[model samples]
Target: MDTKGIEQMLSVLRSTATQASGNVQESGPANAGGVDFAQVLQNSIDKVNQTQKQADQMAEKLAAGDTSQNLHEVMIALQTASVSFQEMVQVRNKLVTAYQDVMNMQV
Candidate 1:
């Protein structure tokens, strides 16, 4: 296991989380805040999309029975991509729940 690589990945994710949360700064009611939210979500979605794409390519190569490419490496990449996409879905769900809660507040 490359602990250093995992640490770097965690550090990058932490920074991204802070940035996406920070991007939601609201200016006024007219803004509706939707544009900022959409932008951040789209950015995240794009990232997951890229992972999915890479995973698909890797899977294709693996399915072709390419001996040169280590099967373990390909499987690990697929799992990593799957988990990342799942985490993104969870994040999206939490964000929507938070937004709903905010909208429900009386004052």
Candidate 2:
């Protein structure tokens, strides 16, 4: 499974948190060396949604007895979509946890 997106998100979160804690100077762009977190998150979600849509189309075509749609290919697409979605959920959980932790921190 591809994890580059998740890694980038985590890296950005760490760097941002460090900067918040006054370890890094805020003289330039907040996320100077990385992509925007919101963009990365949206792209990841879009990718998952696209995969799910493709898998649904493949499954429907297979059900309709389309000769071009192979059963294995449809199954693989479904599995890929499922895995990507699960990964997204996990990332969301982590983000929520981090947010809660930040909220609980002392000023």
Worst 10 residues of 1 by lDDT: 1-10
User: Can you list the residue pairs that collide in candidate 1?
Assistant: none
Which predicted model would earn the best TM-score? 2
How large is the C-alpha RMSD of every model relative to the true structure? 8.2, 2.0
TM-score of each: 0.61, 0.88
User: lDDT per residue, candidate 2, 56-89, as tens digits?
Assistant: 9999999999999999999999999999999899
True-vs-predicted CA distance for residue 69, candidate 1, Å: 2.1
Whole-model Cα lDDT of every candidate shown, in order: 0.65, 0.88
TM-score of 1: 0.61
Best by lDDT: 2
**After superposition on all CA atoms, how large is the RMSD of candidate 2?**
2.0
Relative to the true structure, candidate 2 reaches a TM of 0.88
